[model samples]
Target: MTTSAPPNPSGEDESPAAGTSTTAATSTTRRTTTVTSKVPTVTAAPTSPTTPPATQVTTSTSAAPATEIPDAPGPLSPAARLEEVGTATVDGDELVVVAPSDTARADARQGLAALEIWLNGGDPGSTWTTFAATDPTSDGWRWAAVNRRTGAVVYIR
Candidate 1:
């Protein structure tokens, strides 16, 4: 009886040829695989356009009536009074006149009068006098005098 081996699973011959070298044979198999994933879809809410409120305006056609304005009044000047206080005999002479303690306004008026005279080229020596006067409008007393020869008015601060 003769015995034989089963066929090779790789489909290659197990026996070698006489007087020839033999090499090993290799085989390869390829296979394809697939993968899957699931995801959810999203939806957004819809919006409508809005409208603005209406407005009303009024217009005038006829012109307005004219009005008249009155003229403004002029400035008021203070009234001045003069009275002789004393006299000087010659140039460089001093004439002192003291104002009554109670009559500052009178003193101021006399001083102003002397100043006016000096300003008008009157001899300073003749106009020289010491006196204090107050503004008719205010209570503050001011000292003033005239130069003996030059007629320059001097005010004491």
Candidate 2:
């Protein structure tokens, strides 16, 4: 009796070769396993390009040229501009005051009180004196707080 095995290139199966184990020697080569990967593709949806019925978009722009604007006047401007720009800016909120001399301080307090009276819709105080006349010691140096737009004195002697 005679036996023979088939040739296997993979060498996975240890089956006897056709002429090797059965006859004299079988032939086979060692092989390593290899893996390959494949990926699927993505597709977009279909949209219809239908036309509009009759009207809608009127793309007209009415932009004017840029104009330069003027600046507004400051707060404490007595006539056109106050002589007291850098001196001090006074508002209605400020109340008590101190003067260089007691006489000036007294006159200022009286003036402020008279202003308050005027604001309250009443007659202003009567016996108020102006340092321009009474205090010649200063020799024409008189201090005052006047209204900007109307040139009305707000405080001082």
Candidate 3:
């Protein structure tokens, strides 16, 4: 979901369709941030928005190389970009992921990786469909998604 013309490779046209691969993008109707669908020849630029904040980055270190990926594909697929997560809570005034109690335990990026791995193997059972979580106070809550088939709660904020 996007809300306006997304910022692309700094100064390039913000056209949703103008995006190449690598750079992160948001929908024009909602604030859903994600990456383009393909890997670009050029290394993608850093800095894409998330539910936590617009400037937050999950870096390993100051020298760690940065990567830019596109949005996750349809349901049951490994999320290339975190935005592929379907929203959990829908009643809030602002859009954000509402983490569940287990959010802290299974929330490292590795969990996201695991979910991706599971998805990559082809969502085997029908136990998990998809779901979102709710935080008590964080404005709009954080964006959280759940596996309906396995009862797995993966926090993608």
Deviation of model 3 at 18, angstroms: 99
Off-target runs (Cα >4 Å) in candidate 2 are 1-103, 129-157
Candidates sorted on TM-score, descending:
2, 3, 1
TM-score of 1: 0.18
List pairs with backbone clashes in candidate 1.
108-133, 124-148, 125-148
Q: Global lDDT of each model?
A: 0.40, 0.38, 0.38
Question: Tens digits of per-residue lDDT for model 3 on 55-124?
Answer: 7776674665533221321232232233322332223332333223422333333335443434344442
Model 1 accuracy (lDDT, Cα) = 0.40
lDDT by residue (tens digit), candidate 1, 18-116: 223344335322233344667676777787777655765668788664432112111112332223344422245444333333323333444545644
CA shift of 97, model 1, Å? 18
lDDT of 2 by residue, 2-92 (tens): 5444434555565434343434334545444556668777788788899887878779988885432212211322222212111222354
Residue 56 lDDT in model 2? 83
